[model samples]
Target: MSNIRHHPKTETLAAFAAGRLDEARAVVIATHAAICTECAQAIEEFETVGGAFLEDAEPVALRDDALENVLRRADPGVNVVTPQKPAGDLPETRLPLSAYLEGSIDDVAWRAVAPGLSQSVLKAEGYRPGVLRLLKIAPGVRMPRHSHKGEELTVILRGAYKDEIGDFAVGDLADLDAGDTHTPEAIGDEPCICLIAAAAPLRFKTVLGRIVQPFIGL
Candidate 1:
C-alpha cells in the first residue's frame, strides 16, 4: 500500500487528462500518478469521460481554403522525427522527467539555495515565468518559511519531509496554494529529494528569505 496522504485536486487531474495543463505541471502530475494508484485510477476515469465527450461533440466545418493551405505547407522531402528514449540506467524517480533533464538525478549540477538545501532548476519548453525544480534537503534541515503567490505542487521522490499539512514520503504529493504557508523539514537519514512545480513566485515570510529571493529568482 502507498503512504501518500495528499493528492492533486480533481480539477487538476481532469485538466491533466485533457492535456490542458502546462508542461511543468503535467510532469509533476505524471510523477504522482506513477505511484498513487487512486489518483492514477481517477486520471483514467477522467480520460475516459474526455474521450466520450469528444466522440459526442459535433464536427466543425473547415474553412474553404484550409485543405489547400495545409497541403501547400506540407513538404514531401521533410522527415518526421521521433524522440529518443532516455537511457535505461536512469533512476526510476526521475524517469518521468527524463525529457527535461539532460542526465540522471546524480548528474544534475546542484546550486546551494541555503544551508543544507540545494536545488536544480529544470527547463520546460515554451513555459515562462513558472518554476520547476528538484530540491535536495539534508536530513533535519528545514526550508525557509514561505507561501505561494499562486499554486505549488511537490512530489517526493526519495526520503521524506514534514510540513504543516503532514508527513510526505516517496510518491506522496503536496499541493499548496496561496492560502497555505509552512516550512518543510527534511526527515530520515537520507537527503530528501522532491520535484516541484510552481505557477508563480513564492512569497517568503522572513527578511533573509526575501533578500535572497530576488537573487535566486524564486
Candidate 2:
C-alpha cells in the first residue's frame, strides 16, 4: 500500500496528458505520477480520452510539398539528433527526473541554505526564473515560514513533512499557489528529500529569511 496523501489537480493531470504543461511543471507532475499509482492510472485514462479525441477529429490538408520538404529536412546532410539517456544511479523512483539529477541522490552536492536545511538547484532548459530544486531538511527541523510568489509544486522523494495543510509522506505532492502559505517541518528520523518546482521567488515572512533569500537564490 502507498502512503500518498496529496496529488496534482485533475486539470493539471489533464494538461500533462495533453502535453500542455510547461516543462518544469510537467516534470514535477510526471515524477509524482511515477510514485502514485492512483494518479498514474488517472493520467493513463486522460491520455486514452485524448487519443480518442484526436482520432475523431477531422484531418486538415497540408501544403502541397509538405512531404517533400519533410524528406529533404531528414536528409543525411541534416543533423540527426538522438535522445540522450538519463545519467544517474538513483533508485528508479519511477520518475522522469534522472536526466536532471545526473547522479544518485547521495551524489548530489547540497549547499546549506540555513540550519538543518540544504538545497540543490536543478536546471531545465526552457524554464528560466522558475525555481526547480532538491531540498533536504533534517529530521525535526522546521523551515522558515514563507508564502509563494506564484505556484509551487513539491514531490516528496523520501521521508515525511508536516505543514498547515497536512502531513506529506513519500510519493505525496504538495500543490501550492501564491495565495497559500505554510511552514513545513521535517518528521521522523531520516531527512526529508523533496523535488520542488516553483513558478517564482518565495516571499519569506521573517527578516533573517528575507536577508538570506537573495544569497540562497530561493
Candidate 3:
C-alpha cells in the first residue's frame, strides 16, 4: 500500500463516509480509493469507529414515503442522460500557469508563495474559503518540505511532479495530511500544474523556510 504513497486525511475519510462531500470531490476520492487499499481500509475503519458519533446526533426520522418521493424525481431510465464526453476545450498558452486552469489561469493575479514559486487561486462564481486552489510549480523547483494543517487534496492538471511519494501525472489525485511531509519538484520539460483544496494552512517544517515563514506568508 506504500506504493500509493499519497492519501487523504482521516477526517476527510470520515466526511466521505458521512456523504458530506460533493460529487466532483467525491469522485476524486473514490477514484483514489479504488487504487489504494490502505486508504480504502482506513475509510472502513472510520466508518466503524466513527459510527457512534453520527448516531448520537440523530436526524429526524424520515417519512415512510420520503425515499419513494426522492426516487420519483431522480432519473430511473439510464438513457435519459447524455453520454460522457471527453475533456478538450482548454487552450495551450505561453504563460506557464495559464495552460491548465479550468477556465482562465491567466485571469487570476499570481502570488509569490516563495522565491521560485507562485500560485493562482481560481475563484468560482460562489466558491468560499475552503473551495479550490490551482498551484503552478516552476521548473527545477520544489516546494519546502511541509505537511498540511488540514486535509489537502490535489489533482495533477498538467506535466508531472514527484516527492518521496510516486510521480503524479494528469488525472492523478493525491491526498495529504498533517502527518505527511513532502517536497515535490516539477519534472520533465514542463512546469507542473495541479488543482488543490485545503481547509487549513500549510505548515513548513524546514528550518530555513520556517525562518522566512512570516515573510513568505505561508
Candidate 4:
C-alpha cells in the first residue's frame, strides 16, 4: 500500500464522500481507500468538509407522519434482517470487497475471454449502465488497445502491469475517462489481477479486438 502511485481524482473522491457515486464505482473507490493511506486521508477530508456544509445548511420541516414512519421502520419486529459485518480477518479480497466475494482471490471462478486473459463479472444491485469485473492477465500478455465511452476505474490487486499511461501495482488505481486509450501488459513474473468498474463498454481499436468484443462482452 505504501508504494501506491495512483489514486482516484479529487472530484471522484468528493463524489464518493457525498454518496453520489454509483454502487459499483463506489466499491472500487472504497476498496482502493482501504489500502491507500493517502486516498483514505483525502476521503476523510472530503467527508469532514461535507459534514460542515451540511451543518451550515438551513433546516427543513419534516412531514407530521415522518417520525411515526421512522419509528415503524426502526422496529425490530418488522422482520427485516440487517446484514451483519463479516467477522475477524479479511481475505485478499479486502474489506467491503470481501463482503461481495465468496472467498479470496484464488477462489474466483474465471471465464477465459482470450488467450492468457480471464475475467469474472461481479453481480450486485444498482449497477445499471455499468459493470464490475475482475480481470486476470497472464505474464507477458497485452490487452488490446481501447478507449472508454464513459469512466473506467481499475485497481491492481495482484502482480503488476505497464501501459501507455504508466505502471500499476497492487493498490494502485487507474482512473480513466472518455478518450483514454492504452494497451496494458502484465509485467511481473505472476499474472496481473485487477478489479475494474466500467461505466460503459470499451471501444477496441484493433480488428482482432473488434471481432472478439461481442464474444467477450467487455
Q: What does candidate 1's lDDT look like per residue over 1-218, in tens digits?
A: 36688899888899889988877888899989977889999999999999999999999989999999788777565546665774565456245777777667777899987778888989863444567899999999987789998878899988999998889998888878765898999999999999998888789999888988877666
Per-residue lDDT for 96-213 in model 2, tens only? 8877875677778899988788999888745345667899999999887899988889999889999999999988899897768889999999999999988888899988878988
Evaluate model 2: give its lDDT. 0.85
Best by TM-score: 4
After superposition, candidate 2 runs with Cα above 4 Å error:
64-90, 127-129
Q: After superposition on all CA atoms, what RMSD does each candidate show versus the true structure?
A: 3.1, 3.0, 7.4, 2.4
Q: Write the per-residue lDDT of candidate 3 for residues 78-177, one digit (tens) a residue.
A: 4376743333455322222232344354455678777767676554222333545667887778888888776667877667898887888765667776
- The clash count for each model shown is 0, 0, 1, 0
Which regions of candidate 4 fall more than 4 Å away from where they truly are? 64-93, 125-128
Tens digits of per-residue lDDT, candidate 4, 1-218, equal 58899899999999999988887888899999989989999999999999999999999999999999998988988768776664545446456777777777778999999999999999844646668899999999999999999999999989999999899999999999888998999998999999999988999999999999998878
Question: Which 10 successive residues of model 2 have the least lDDT summed?
Answer: 86-95
Question: TM-score of predicted model 1?
Answer: 0.85
Clash number for model 1?
0
Question: How far off is residue 126 in model 2, in Å?
Answer: 2.4
Q: Arrange candidates, best lDDT first.
A: 4, 2, 1, 3
Q: What's model 4's overall lDDT?
A: 0.89
